[model samples]
Target chain A: MNVTIIGTGNVGQYLIRFFSKIENINLQICGRNSNVLHQFAVECECATVDSIKKIDTNADFTLLAVSDNAYKEVIEQMPNVKGIVIHTAGSVPLAVFGAKFNRCGVMYPLQTFSATRKSDFKNIPFCVEASDTDTLNKIHKLSKKLSKDVRFMNSEQRKVIHLAAVFACNFTNHMYSVAAKILESQHIPFAVFQALITETAKKACEMNPVLAQTGPAMRNDQSTIKSHLEILESNADLQKLYSFVSESIANFKKQEDIND
Target chain B: MNVTIIGTGNVGQYLIRFFSKIENINLQICGRNSNVLHQFAVECECATVDSIKKIDTNADFTLLAVSDNAYKEVIEQMPNVKGIVIHTAGSVPLAVFGAKFNRCGVMYPLQTFSATRKSDFKNIPFCVEASDTDTLNKIHKLSKKLSKDVRFMNSEQRKVIHLAAVFACNFTNHMYSVAAKILESQHIPFAVFQALITETAKKACEMNPVLAQTGPAMRNDQSTIKSHLEILESNADLQKLYSFVSESIANFKKQEDIND
Candidate 1:
């Protein structure tokens, strides 16, 4: 299978790394800069082009791994191709490809990526959606080569998944950032909390997170909650977050109790 | 060196398990029920007492691992001795041990514990505080036996650490619970998100979490944010939480930009 990837961003480069490793797949990359694209091509040991218009249309799949905001512009610029066009965005819908492309789909990898960090896609779930079953099957089969888990989800379901990820990945990370700030204020290194944070994530994943919940909020310990709030008094934003989240936890527990 | 544990809850039992493994420590455990204490003593391979009053005061340290609510009553009922008194709670002050005990300190391990979970103390940070240097050194030495990382933090500092942990561990776990709930509503198993959640935590811990932040809020992608809020509209509590956290993330990014 000949796969062409547009947008030499983190996600595109990430796919290139894995797709290149697969023996049967011939991959080419597209970037906005020729000199940088040439250098990246040498580094990745793959073919590269400077523009999406210059990309080979004979490819099995042309993955637009660009930012969601650039989706329409990139699609409009790409050459008309016989192969399926896919996007690697979490939020963008398949119909964004428009009537210009006959075969279009989405193959959103549900994981965060960075240039310096090593990401193993073996266990990562790839959410695949297509306009047709044939396109879906092809993408699912290709996704399986990179990961063990691949699920077919429409644009609506994928949108929910992406939203859930903001809570699971983004907001959860913000909590760590907040905690690090608190520890930093005390002249303590955030490293000390690493083990506990790691274990907390581990336990939540291993069990039903609702059942795995703990702390003053779960216990409804007014004294501890009061002390925590007082500690946050100087930072109104965090103080507000602490109160809102604590009350939500209490309310969740109350609802559970009533249901029981 | 004799150490008597005056509670058999998860934290107490956790200490008992590790303490019994150390060769120099002679550990005795106490419980409210005689039969339970006897069985626990047999399992831990240590001495047991049904009452804190009957606890061997000749011990070098008496650890009151009771909950914060039970601290006052537990201390009031205990008979005095020369051995330093210690409590293993985060928010509770060293003064809570009070004027009754001449030598007192705290040995609060900063981690969540459950009865069934296997907690490794090797890397868990133990936050220790004391009224006197002598008691501090003794508790610090004992704490080192269980964990490689032990720090001397006074009551005020310890309170802040506990408050920080509420965000790092408790509030973070709540975010996972909310995410799980969102996925469950879509009939998608929460297991699919395990890899992303794990990596989110790993990245935050390995790097500055503020720098590690990603997604719509960090990008200030209002369209994505609007869609997420729309999806969450049915659940007023979650919608409120989503909006609040998203705004906080944006505010946090703005603060970071100013600092830079």
Candidate 2:
């Protein structure tokens, strides 16, 4: 299959690297930035295009890996093609491609992408969505080649998935930042918490997260929570966060009790 | 050196397993549960005690790995003679041991403990706190045998360290739980978001978390945030949490911008 990827950012770069390794897939990398396009092309030994207008219509798949803001503009600029057009977005809808394209779908990889970090796509889940049965099958086949975990999901489903990702990945990491900042204020090294952080994450993965939950909030050790809040009192932001999250956890625990 | 582990919970089990592997240490495992004591003693080939009164003070090191509520009772029950008495707690103070014994300190392994899940202690940080220099050196040497990452910290420092850990690990995992719950409500498999969660965590570890922060909250995409809130509105607790955390991230981002 011939695959043309638009946008040479982290996502595009990673997809290029991943797809380049697939023996049967012929890859073409594209981005508005000529420098990045040339750079990725040189690195991957794949064809590079500066604009979507130059995308090959004969290609089997055209993947719009661009930013959410640039989706409509990029899709509008792409050459009139009969090949399947897919956007690798978690939040965007498939209908954005319009009825003009031969096929439209989403191949959203549920993972953070970065140029330097190599991801094991085989373990990562790819949420696939298509407007038609044939297009869906094609994307599903491609998804299976990359990962063992794949699911057929529509725009609405993808949106919920994206929201969940924000809570699990994005917000979780933000909490880490909050912790780091607190430690930084006290001149304590963040490395002190690395082991604890990693192990906590592994536990959540191993069991139901609710069961894995711990700390003062979960235990309802008001004394300890109060002491912690006192320590964080100087930082109003953290204080607010502490109260909010602690209350939420407490409420969840209470709900669990009632259910039981 | 003789080591008495005064709790047969997760930490106690790990310590027994760890110390049992080392040739020089004499292990004494104690717990209130007779069956648990018998099981650990038979499996680990160590001495077991059902009562705290059975604790031998002649040991080179006494590790109190009990729950917070049971710590004081266990400590009070220990025999008079002592070498080094240490507690594996994050919040408990070193001074709590007082000058009642010859040597007292802390050997807090900064990680979530679970019997089923085996952790590689080689890299996990052991925060060693001692009342005096000689005791500190002894604990540090013992820590070095198990882990490469060992640091001398005071009770005050450990308190802050625990607080930071709550945010980084415990709170972060809760965020993941919230994410999983959201996805579950939508009839989506939580496994689909694993890739994004893993990558996001890996990225935060690679760089400063604050710099790596992204999402509608960080971007101040109020429309997206509003939509997400609407999805979570039925769950009032979660909705409130979402709003508060989003607002906190926005404010933090603003502060970061100002600092820059």
Candidate 3:
């Protein structure tokens, strides 16, 4: 298979690393940044293109891995293609390609990615959606080259999954930063809470997440909640979040009681 | 070393399991219910005490692993100890033991525990605190038996850590439940997001959490945020939460821009 990946960002670079390892695929990497593109090409051992226009016109597929904002412009500017076109965006929909391309799809990897961090895609879920059956299957088979878990969803469903990823992956990660900030202010090591964070994620996955919930917030311990709020006295944003999340947990616990 | 554990709850039972493996520790497990206590005794091969009164007075240390609410009453009721009397509640202050027990401390394992699920404590952080130096050292050394990362903090510091734990562990787990609930309503498997959750946790620990952050919220993409809010329109609580957390993230991103 001849595959051209546009955008040498984290998702694009990682895909280069992944497809480079595959024996049969001929992969070409493209991005505007010549230095970054050259580095990725050398590192991942894939062909590099200075512009999307230079991408192989006869390639079997085009993996659009640019920023969400760049997708529309990139789709508009890139040379028209007959091969399968797939995007590696979370929230962006497949319809963005519209009738412009005969074959197009979405190939969203629901995990946090950064240009510097090397991530394992083996168990990561690839959300695949396409304009038609042939394109969907092509994207699916190709996605299997990188990930074990692949699920087919339409535009609406992928958006929902992306929203959930925001909460599960993005928001959950920000909570770690929040905790780290709190600890840093106190001159405590960020690691003092690392085990707890790891355990919380593991336990939620192991059991029903609601049942796995614990802490003063879940129990509605007003005194502890008040204490926590007091600690966040200077940060109005944190105080608000602490109150809202605690109230939500308490409300859920109450609803569970009524159901019981 | 003789150790008596007061409470047969998840933390207590897990402590029983952890301590059972160590050869030199003579362990006694106690709780209100005989069936449960006897069951733990039979399963873990530890001595069972029907009440705190039945625990041997000569024990080197006593672990109070009961719920936060029960700490005050349980501490008052437990037999006076010459050795350190430690409670496992995170938010509860070490000052709670002052004037009550000559030797008292805290052995808070910073992880969520459920009675049914067994957890490995080898890497979990134990936030140890005590009323006095001798008790602190004793608790610190004992904490090593259960976990490698043993941190010493004062009552105020531990309370702050506990507060931080509520954000890092409790609030983060709640986010998983929230994401799962959204996906569950859409007939999508919660397992789809499991890899993302695991990666988020692992990545946050590996790098500076704030720097590791990603997603639409972090980007302040109003369009994506609006789209997500539209999907969550019917659920007011979720809508409120989604809006608040996103706003907080956007605010943080704005602050980061200023800093940069």
Candidate 4:
């Protein structure tokens, strides 16, 4: 099967590298930047193009792995393909394809990607959606080749998952950033929290995150809360965040007791 | 060296199991709950005492792993120990030791523990503090046996680290709980985002958490943000948290650009 992956950003590059490794697959990679695309092509040993128009329509799977904003421009001028087309976005709906293409779907790989590190997609969950059984089955058969966990989700469900990804991955990452800054100010090495962060994620996955909760806020330890707030007093945003999250934890704990 | 552990909570239990495995160390376990104490004693093969008063002063180290509120009450009547005294609380200050003991220190292990799983202390960060070098060195030497990352932190710095733990561990887990709830409401399996959560945490630790930040909030994609808010419109607390964190991320991104 011929698979064309568009864009050269993290997700696009990741798809290119991942699909290149699979058996019985022909890969074509395209991006707006020729220099980077050329570099990536040599690095991943795949075909590269400057425009989607250059992509042969004979490809079995065309995956648009571009940025959310660029999706419109790319899709607007995107030539209709005889093959199944898909976008690898968490938030972007499959409807963006509209009637422009007979067979289009979403095959979003539900994981964060970065060019710096190699992503192992074998165990990653792929949230796949399409307009019909034929397109979805094609996406499913293709998705199963890459990931062990593949699910069919509607647009709203995918968006919900995306929002949750924001809270779980993106926002939680920001929380880590806040913590790093707090330690950085005191000259504490970021290494101190590495094991804690890993273990916290592990515990959350093992059980319900609500049950895995710990620390001062969950315990309603006012003195600790006061101490933390005092330390964060200078930063208005952090101070606000710390207070709001603590209150939420306390509230959750209370509800937990009532439920018990 | 003889060690006495006061309490049977998760931290205390973890310490009991961990320290029991070390060579050339004697363990004494105490707690108010006899049944739990008996269970732990049988489980860990240590002497169990119902009162802190029953613990002898001959121990080389005595660790109070009780809750924060109970620390004062337990310590007020805690027999003066010839051993180094320490508490495992993240927020509680070492000053609580006062003149009550000559070698009082803090040995706050910077991780969340649960009774369900065995905690590996080999990589966990142990934040140590003491009134003098002799005590500090003794604690540090002892800490090195269990963990490679032994840190000499003052009461204030330890508290700061503990506060950051709240954000990085407790708050991050809460975010996962929110994500799970969101997925549950939409009839989607929580497993869909497990890889994303794990990858996000891994990325956060590999580099600066600020640089690892992603998602709609980081992008300042107002459209995506608005859609998320609409979905969370009913939960006032969640809505508030969503906006507060998104705004914080956007503001941080702005500051990052300025720094660049």
Candidate 5:
């Protein structure tokens, strides 16, 4: 199958490299930056284009790997393609592509992608959403080639998943940043927290997070929690965060007790 | 060094097995429950003791791997001896041991220990803290036998590190539980989010979390954020958490720009 990928950013680059590895698949990578396009073309041994107009309409699939805000414009720019048009987005709806194409869907990889690291997509879950059965089947087949874990999810389901990810991944990382900042202010080395941070992740993987939850907040150890608040007293944002998350965990534990 | 682990819970069991694998180190496992101690002794090929009074104080080191609340009682029960007394605790202060013992310290492994899965302590940081240089050196040497990464940190530093870990690891996992609940409520499989969670953690490990942060909250995409809040309206606690974290991220990004 012939495939045209739009965008040469991290997501685009990773997808190009991933699709290039699959057998019997023709790939074309397009980006606004000619230099990036050329670099990717040279690296992945695939066709490179400077504009969406250059994308072959005869291709079996046109994958939009562009930013969510730029998605609508790129979809409009693609030459009246007869092939399936899909986007690699988590928040945006599939209907953004409209009903003009023969088939349209979303092939969202539920992982954070970076060009520097080789992503192991084989076990990564692919949330596939399509407008029709034929398009879904094609996307499914393509996803299977790259990953073993695939799921059919609607736009609403995908949005919820994305929101949860914001809390789980993005916000959680921000929490790390807050902790780092606090440590930095206190003249402590970041390495001091590295082991604890890693083990916390491992613990969550070992069991249900609710059960694995530990901390002054989770235990309702008011003395330590109060001391932590005092330490974070200067930063209003962190103080607010500390109070909010602590209360949330306490509430969760209380509800858990009720359920039990 | 001859070591006696005074708890047969996850941490105690894993530590016993780990110390057993190290040559020249004699390990004796103990717990209040004789049955559990017998099982650990048989399975791990170590001696067991039912009472703290039966502890071989002549051993090179005694590790109190019990719960935080039970720490005082356990320490009080142990027979007074000359060997180093170390506890594996993150929040509990070293001063808790009092000046009764000449050699007292902490050998806190900053990771969640599970008996089911073998942990590679090679990368796990061991935060060693003590009242004296000799005790600290001895603990450091002992930590080197288990992990390559060992650092001497004060009690205050370790406490802050523990707080940061709550944000990075514990809170992050709670976010996953929230995501799982959302998926479950919508009749969607929770496995769909596993890839995203793993990749997110891996991404943070590669880059500064500040640079890697992305989402509607980070972007300040009010519309999508609003939509997400609406979806979570049924969950008041979750809604509050979502708003608090999103606002915190926005505020943090603002501060970052100002600093830059």
Candidate 6:
């Protein structure tokens, strides 16, 4: 399989490394920055190109790992290819290719990536969607080389999952940031909450998160809730967020109870 | 050290187990429910008392592990104790002990406890506060037996930390619950998000969560945000929460940028 990955960003770099490991795979890295592309090419021992138009038309797959906002410009710069083209974005739809490309798909990896840490794709779910069955199967085969958990999802499902990922990964990180700020004000090291945070995430993953929920809000302890709101009075934004989320939790519990 | 636990709830049971393991510690279980107290006493091999009045005055510490709302009623029923009397609640201030007890303290274990899982105290932080140094030290020694991360916190500091904990632990868990609901609505398995949730938490603990933030909100990707809001239109509560939290993230970024 000849796979060409465009964009030299985090996702692009990740795919370069992953694709380079598979047997009988000819991996290529594409980017406008020649220096970084050269550096990554040397690091991954893959071919590097400065333009997507220079990519071989015969390549089995061309994966555009660029930012969503740049998709249109990048797609316009691409040369018509006979092989499948896919974008590695969660929220982007396959139709983003429009009539510009005949064979197109999406291979959105559902995981958080950080430059400081190495990501293992063994358990990461790759959400694959293609314009046709054959293209889908080809993308699935390619995704299987990187991860075992790959699913065929439509654009709507993928979009919803992306939104869910925002809550699970991004919003959750914001909660941590808020906690860090609150602790900083009290001269308390954020380290104290590390164990609790890790444990809470583990529990949520292993069990039904709604059922595993705990804390004052879950108990609907008006006294503790009031106390927490008072503590956040200095920061109106946090206070608003704290009160709103608490109410959501209480209402969610009620909704669940009614469902049961 | 003689320790009497005055409740049969989760926190009380955890203390009963921890205290039972220490050498030279005489353990006693005191609760209004005789049947539950008797069973716990048998299981823990400790003395059982149907009333706090029957508790020995010479007991080194009496740990009240009841809910915050029950603190007043429970403390009202307490017999005068020469040893330290402490409650294991986070938001409750030390002043709640009042003038009835000469030696009153607090040992708030900052962690989420669920009946389905076993909790390890090796890394859990114990926030200790007291009326005097003597009581504080006594409680610190007991806390050290269970966890290495013990700190002397004032009532105000402890209250702030408790509020921070609600964000880090409770609010974070609520994020997972929301994500789970979103996935459920789309017929997507929640299992797909496990790796992302776990990785997000580990990164937040190891680095500054604000710096570690990613996703459409962090990027201010208006297109992705708009699409998500459209998908969430059916649920007004989640839609409001989604918009509010995203705005908070953007504002938090702006605030941090100013600080820098």
> Against the unseen true structure, what C-alpha lDDT does each candidate score?
0.89, 0.83, 0.85, 0.88, 0.80, 0.89
Q: Show model 2 residue runs off by greater than 4 Å.
A: A24-26, A76-79
Error of 1 at B3 (Å): 1.5
Q: Which ten residues in a row have the lowest lDDT in candidate 1 chain B?
A: B32-41
For model 6, the docking class works out as high
Greater TM-score among 2 and 5 belongs to 2
A1-260 per-residue lDDT for model 4 (tens digits): 88898888889878888888898787888789888888877877888788888997889989998887678889988887899889999888888887898889999888888778897999898989998898999899999988888888888888898888989998899999999989988899888999999999999988889898888888788877888899988998999999998888888788789989
TM, every model: 0.96, 0.93, 0.96, 0.97, 0.90, 0.96
DockQ of model 2, rounded to 2 decimals: 0.67
Local accuracy of candidate 3 as per-residue lDDT tens digits, B1-260: 99988888878888888998988988998888888977877877888878877787788988888888778887777777777788888888887775977888888888888887877998888888887788888899899988888988777888888888888988998899889889988899888878888888989888888899888787767788888899999999999999998888888888889999
CAPRI grade of model 5: medium
Candidate 6 lDDT, A22-52, residue by residue in tens: 8998888888888888887788788888878
Docking class of 3: high
DockQ of each: 0.82, 0.67, 0.81, 0.84, 0.54, 0.85
What's the number of clashes in each of the models?
Answer: 0, 2, 0, 0, 0, 0
User: In candidate 5, what are the lDDT values of residues B1-260, reduced to their tens digit?
Assistant: 68888998777877888888988877887787878777877777888888788889799899989876678877777798779999998778898898768999998887766556676778888889987898899899999999998878788887777677767766776776777677777787666666666666666666667777877777778878888899898889999898988888898899899999
For residues B33-60, what per-residue lDDT tens digits would candidate 2 score against the true structure? 8888888778889998887788876888
DockQ of 5: 0.54
Q: What is the C-alpha lDDT profile of model 6 across B64-84, one tens digit per residue?
A: 998888898889888788888
True contacts kept of each: 0.78, 0.73, 0.85, 0.85, 0.62, 0.87
Candidate 6, superposed: residue stretches over 4 Å from native: B32-39
Error of model 2, residue B63, in angstroms: 1.2
Ten contiguous residues minimizing lDDT sum, candidate 6 chain A: A111-120
Q: What are the per-residue Cα lDDT tens digits for candidate 5 across A27-139?
A: 99888988888887788789988888888888898888987777888877779988888899888998897777768999998877766778778988888989989889999
Q: After superposition, how far is residue B120 of candidate 3 from its true place, in Å?
A: 2.0
